[model samples]
Target: MPTTPVVSRRRVMAALFTGVACMNIAMAGASTAGVLIATESPGPGWSGVPSAAGVLGTAAGALGSARLVVSHGRRRSLLITYGLGSFGALLAAAGAVTGLFPVLLVGLLVLGLGNGGAQLSRYAAADLYPDERKGQALSAIVWAGTVGALAGPPLIAPAARTADLLGLPGLAGPLLVAALVTAAAAVVSAALPRSIPDAHPRTPETSGSEGFAVAFAQRAVRGPLLAMVAAQVAMVAMMTMSAPQLHQHGHGLDVVGWILTAHMIGMFALAPLSGRIADRWGGRVTIFAGIGTLAVASAAAVAAPTSHTAGIPLSLFLLGYGWNLVFVGGSSLLSTQHRKLQGTVDAVVWSTSALAGLAAGPLFALGGYVLVAVVAGVAALIPLVALTDH
Candidate 1:
């Protein structure tokens, strides 16, 4: 008798991690390009517009992808989202060539949708592993992002040279790279298994509202949800403004890239350790550690001089590190609870994060980096209100 062949979980996870790494490359490249383009444009407070639009798209995309995951599956949803990202990157490239700010904004919005979908990859990783290793699985996938994140900023110069050689606008070069990478991600996503192990299988009769109610009713879920939201708000608000703020203080692109690279390292380099901490000590304890780290980081940011020096990079790194702990720990907590409602729970988390990103621009404009840092510090403290011994 012929035996059925089984796909290895390790292979599936490896493919997923590769896709996520590619997606992060595209995202980081777009971010660097957006900052340069927006800064060079003649306008007051326009630097944040692209990021805001992208974040709004991310919010919408998260909800949309969640619904698609519920209806179709992870593979299809990821493919569609990556396709949208490719289209968005093309638009962004064209906009850069034409020097059209509005078009660039629109393109970034579309790209954000893809980003939202990519964020789901972490959750998918959790589904593939046993409960005890959930944190490790999720963090391993997230750690894959380090490759792209660290590489993207450095590629800005090379991409610009490539654009010049191709007779395209220098700023548009990264977007072109983004388009190619995102398309590759889509192809890779197509190879994902039809069904993930331990994934929640709901009937067509199940509704998003039903999932949401189930998640909200549980205290275990609610606390982690709040921690995730707070972490996102604090992280996004500070990180988005860091580049522009440094640029305004007369830092060059290379310097900015280096600082951002350091930040990205902090974000992904310690994922394995963070995951182990979460698994061994519990998510709540990890969250508390993250909050304390964020508090100190924010204080350092407020005190750091506006120079192209080690101070800013160190501060940013700390900030990123703190965010990583909260994100991985909180996500593990969520994954452990109400596994059946994963999609809806993720939607809520991403949507809240999107809103926070959207709000960051105006907040920065109002009170400068110090105000933003203060606000972020305050937000970081929110998880304390819902702390539990569990």
Candidate 2:
């Protein structure tokens, strides 16, 4: 009898991780540019454009990617999304050079779509492992973001220099760099072996919309989804406004960069430990702990004086750490809930999260930093009320 060929899980995981890291590099770079470009926009209240566009783009991307994953498989979905991201980056760069706000906004939205697709790579990592080890695998892929997060911001200056050499606007440099990195990621994604199994078998009857309907019908699934949404809303709302708030308080750009880096570290550096905690203690316990931490961090942000430099960074770090816990815990729980509807379930989580993020900018504009923090703290408590041990 002929034996079946054995696929190397390690090699496949390595490829996924590499692709994820490259995507992160593009994401981080684009994110930095998004903020700066938004700040430079001529229109009043345009600072939120990128954030809103990001949220909207993510919603669209999540739905589209989910459908593609259901029909075509993960590698093809990733390849297409990354290509979209590269094109978006180029558009953004062009917008920067020409000072076209609409073009820039559109680019940010498309770039965000790319991020949405990359976010699913974590689930893909988990798919390769057994249930008991899913948390670790997911967190390992998430931890890969640390490399890109650390490397991305520092490139701003270098990117500026490159832009000058190429006779482009300085602000356009990061977007151009984003385009290159994401394009490379597309190539890497295209190389992914088709033999790697999906997390769940696709069902022809369950289209993306039907999958959402089915997943949302379950109480167990709703709990995790709500947890993820609250975490994302709170984290993105606060983190998005942090730089401008600090800059308004007279902090330098370099300081903002360092603080953002610290936040990223909090988000990704300790993810493995968070995963282990979830596995050992149960996701419910871990989620409660995460919410508690987030509450404390938000309270700290509200209480700390604007001049207290150390306080803000510390609070941001705590916020990121809290987000990491909830994110990992909630994701693990979701993965276990309905294996067959993984793509749609993930899409719903991201789309809801994106809607919350879209609201964040306007919230900040209307209520200021304190209001954002207060609202985030309150939002974090909703999961506590909704989630129960199953």
Candidate 3:
């Protein structure tokens, strides 16, 4: 067994983390304004665009992942993903200028592709370190995304200002910023050590090629997949309604912003540690904790906003943290379970998640806030029951 080049576990983790966050910065900005832009040009049709775009992105990402795994390999695939991400940003900026809804949709689709691919690349974080520390490393890489996540919406303010100068909405500015972040991530990837798939040539466990069927059959992979899908769907469903829900309860947009910021803060704050816990205790425990937290949070939200402004934010924060924990924990497990099928399994997982979001989005939009939250909360618990038998 050849020893991997020794690097600062912390530095490698940090670099990957920055790399992941940078990839999404643009999309994050666009997401902040997605509904508004949709409503402006397309009217109510815009209401469905975000979730639809999410589905397209997930599908594209699945295809992109397979291609990356086959041709460029993991490291190069990440670089390609970064480039695509940046191009998506540029495309989005252009759409904002011309008011071309189709072009905007196309750009969003491409951005989705990049998002799918960049997120899948996080699984490769396990490759950068020895097996023993893999979970922690994966968590660290994901934790880095928190930086971009936080920056995504906030960056919109300045971006909006910049776009206004160009006679476009501020939305264009964030796309430009996203492009810059993607470019930077690509540069960093160029410096990374080559990525080795979990399945090595010498290992008997290496199955070589993993078609969709085999990947789906694995319990370890399936467990986290369920967790990811549920958590993600719930998160998006809740998030989509955050502004309205807060408003219904008499909270303003500023208060809504505070809730979102707090949610993101909770998500990243515990990620690295969660990763370490996954490494120490295993993915199942962390996932269990995450699912439990989400169930509780959902119940709190269903209870409705109270006089305590902090309650919703606090619940959302826990939701974010719980989501982060489950995702990283599940991702780590999936990486190991189907080493040869990493990309395939990832595609399946994310695509399933995307579809779930697609189904949940409008339902939430039409169902109103409380129903969506309750349904998502209740749904998250289903995986817990099904997977415990394993």
Candidate 4:
């Protein structure tokens, strides 16, 4: 159920785009920094911990945001989520400064919450448009990540340099920048026009474990849910391992950064086109394309060594676009669902991705990147069987 807006749809949409871009920039910087920062700690392995924490936080945030929207509406939900994101960033910075992995992980978790909020902004965009235009609306918000993709990696060096000069951890700079920008993102949340409240606010009886059970019980919800989860699991598992894989192969942060940039571009740059495909050819076709590309990406990763010039980066790029397809396709499938389901769907997706993140390290350790890629390719296939004309 969407609330009627007092303001023009375009104004609200612009704010959503801007707010998403800001979150992406912060996330991009923090992701690299988090990896580098975590590596500094001495332990059995931090590979899965940081990404897992962030993703878990994302799952929590997604769930919380949906319930919040049901009662208070989208704008209020955005405000709360971004605010938590900002505080979480600062907490992460403190962790960096004190050389405490626990603190850093906690901060990352909170920051993930904010990111989770940003992720659902696409659904907020969905409320403004009709079903016919939902794909484009979702894509417009998703494409905003391209800004982060291009701008984020470049900031790593300069932000780290600033940190070094400030006598802080070299990697702390990006986290600090993340903190600042996420704060701004919270302010941007205010720009979203207020939503007309649902006729009846969701009571605890209708919104907790019972609520989720009811929503998940619907047969129509299951297909898109599986597709969403598959994309996230495959993408997150491969991605969580990519940086460490590169570092192990003697690639520097600069190379890792460049590769990530390519990956982000693939994830976001052509979102409009993907959205159009969903709109024109239908989400089933769009989802098929995503699943196919993910398989190819996995095979590509296996076909060549990490050092191969184009193999890893190009594979990652395809992987990103593949995730995009499923993401857009999945969301578009839900355009007709009760808006209450958006948050839960996103929560499930991120939650599985968190598990995927946790699993990547062990999988890599056992059979190396090949095994992880294989796992991802296999996950993509699960949804293919469930997808229908919808």
Candidate 5:
């Protein structure tokens, strides 16, 4: 049976803070690639390593989550996530200091595994609320992370400079700060109420692998999953390429930081209320609106990279906001569809999104910004069309 609706604002705040810490650490790993590629010529083909690390981490985490979903359950899995992530952050920092690419790869892989697990933690947040308000709870968790994402780069900036002063690579300093963030997340995770154990209540009709199979085969699950998969690819591709896109157009890293912050603001600022829209309007309506927003954002980005005058920031902001809507809506739908089999559905969602992102990076590199934006826009249109037709 579903739990009571006891998610007070205070509890929501606490949970959001916990999630934010974990997300901050997870996202900080991504900046490592940019830092590495910029600071050191890692030779040709190595430019993609950091992004690969993130993907690999996500994959590992997803797989681990799958195993835990069947075995120890969600809460225990998250505990392992924070614990391993803390160690991975430390190891990555050490590898950066020593300039050991191999070690860095290993460390990042561990971090990625942790990331996969942390991603599922958002679902745990949703479970804290009642079915009617699950989307709102999920959005609150995402919104909490928005602050960390905005501040993430600056957090490591000073450390990077200090590392440079101390005759160490700047990546070293950022890794250290990331470690602290991970540790903090671990402490927060410790505070989560353990009242509800990992697995949802099982029944003859909705238990085990058979239940998962049935859910996936259903038409309702398919629509949301398809929409979610496409939206994830576009959002990840745009965000991944933003730095390069900005750089090519004569904007510095600082500008990229500001743009990212604006994007975060766009997503987080509206999150509190966006989920409520899902509650009132249904996920399908919100999903279409979200995709439309992304389509506009993508078109704007493709048409004008040099035009940073309000338009660029506004476009990116819309893009971010659109992503939040799609994610929240898609997730809400999944929760509704799977109900008892949420953990399994979440695994599929994360895996699909990660695979899409993994594919997006190389596509962006080969096709460049214009082509990538077009691809993302086209992809966004698929969901829009589907939703409109329905």
Candidate 6:
């Protein structure tokens, strides 16, 4: 295996970290604005459009960015991705100002593309480090999201006020902030040097779907990818639809916000520790633990009564941690794959997550939250059972 110089690797890692953190800041703010945009329409017909568009964009972005990475190297590909994000944010802001729903959707879709590029940065970071160090590096990048989660929300009102001063719609303020922040991400991404010793050879992956098929046929690729996908499906389905269940139970938006905060803490706060666990115990054990925790969390949700809000939050926290473990562990395992396949796998992960989210409402309505939790649990078990062969 090749080795990157420690200094060079660290510099690139720091760049990826800063870029992803900034992108998330934009994402959170834009997401809030998107929800508002969706709600601007009467009734519940369009409530989920913004999120759906973003997810679909993320899926497309991941595939497109990965191809670019194959042909153009990390730096150039990242530049294009984040540039798209910034432009998308600006377009979305224009939609807000003009009251054009289609424009807002298009902008969000583009912003999600940029976000997809940022998501792939974790893989680029992995490529810079040795096998032993990949977990720590990936975790460090994932941990950067905590900064966005903490900082993004507070900026919304101020951004809205700033927009008011500019004579734009108040919601456009956050989108404007998103534009600036994503452009900063583009700048940070521009600073990434070729950290790989044998960097950017333009692999066969750029050729066509055949390359992806061959790569995915490998045992190493299949296990980690499947585990990662399961984690995503479970997490998105359970988490996205939980709010409706809370609402049905008469819980207010404040309670929902507080619970989601707990979930974010569970997701991002202990990422370094999660990385350590993966590095120490190996991916198989880490994924097993993750699956177990997720299954338990799902069961807990079913067991907890509506009035028992405390239990619900605890379950959500557990859900987030479970997802972190699966994702971090699976990613570390997948790190050894060909560079071109990285973005492709992530694209599939996001697409599956979007589908799960779309199905969540219907699943929840069928048997209420119980059915959704059951479905998530079933999804979690797929990789668990299959990876037993690993």
Top TM-score: which candidate number?
4
* TM-score of each candidate structure, all chains considered together: 0.90, 0.90, 0.87, 0.92, 0.85, 0.86
In model 6, which runs have C-alpha deviations exceeding 4 angstroms?
36-42, 154-171, 194-210, 242-258, 303-309, 364-371
* 1-390: candidate 6 lDDT, tens digit per residue: 556677887788888899888987887678666765554453233444576677778888888888787778778888999999999999999988998889998998999999898888888877666778789888888888877767675677678888899888888988999999999998888778843433223345443445778877877778888988898888877776665667567755456556766666677778898899999999878888889989988888878736335767887788888988988898898776666677789888888787876676567656777788888988988986578775
lDDT of 5 by residue, 352-385 (tens): 5555555555665677666767887888778554
Clashes of each: 0, 0, 1, 0, 1, 0
Worst 10 residues of 4 by lDDT: 196-205
Per-model lDDT: 0.78, 0.75, 0.67, 0.82, 0.66, 0.78
lDDT for 380 in candidate 2 is 85
Per residue, candidate 4 scores C-alpha lDDT tens digits across 251-308 of 8767877888888899999999999999998887888899998999989988864853
Tens digits of lDDT, candidate 1, 94-133: 9999999889989988987887788778887887666778
Q: By lDDT, who's the top model here?
A: 4
Ranking by lDDT: 4, 6, 1, 2, 3, 5
Q: In model 2, how many backbone clashes occur?
A: 0
Q: After superposition, how far is residue 344 of candidate 3 from its true place, in Å?
A: 2.4
After the best TM-score superposition of candidate 1, give how far the Cα of residue 376 lies from its true spot, in angstroms. Answer: 1.6
Assess the local accuracy of residue 360 in candidate 6 as a C-alpha lDDT between 0 and 100: 68
lDDT comparing candidate 1 with the true structure: 0.78
Please give the distance, in angstroms, between residue 76's alpha carbon in candidate 5 and its true position after superposition.
2.3
lDDT by residue for model 2 over 1-390, one digit each (tens)?
222223656766777887778877776667667766776565214555576676667667766776677678888888888899889989988888998978987997898778778777888777777777788988998888887768776677678778989988887898899899889888888778775664444345643334556667677677777887888778877777776677567775567667777777888888899889878887777788889989988998888726336767787888888988988888888665433355555566656666555566677678777887888888888888778645
> Cα deviation in Å at residue 151, candidate 3?
2.2
Per-residue CA lDDT of model 3 for 171-245, tens digit only, reads 677667767877788788776557453412233245556665665677766777878777876776666556445
Predicted structure 6: lDDT: 0.78
Provide the clash count, candidate 3.
1
Each prediction's RMSD to truth: 3.2, 3.1, 3.1, 3.1, 3.4, 3.4
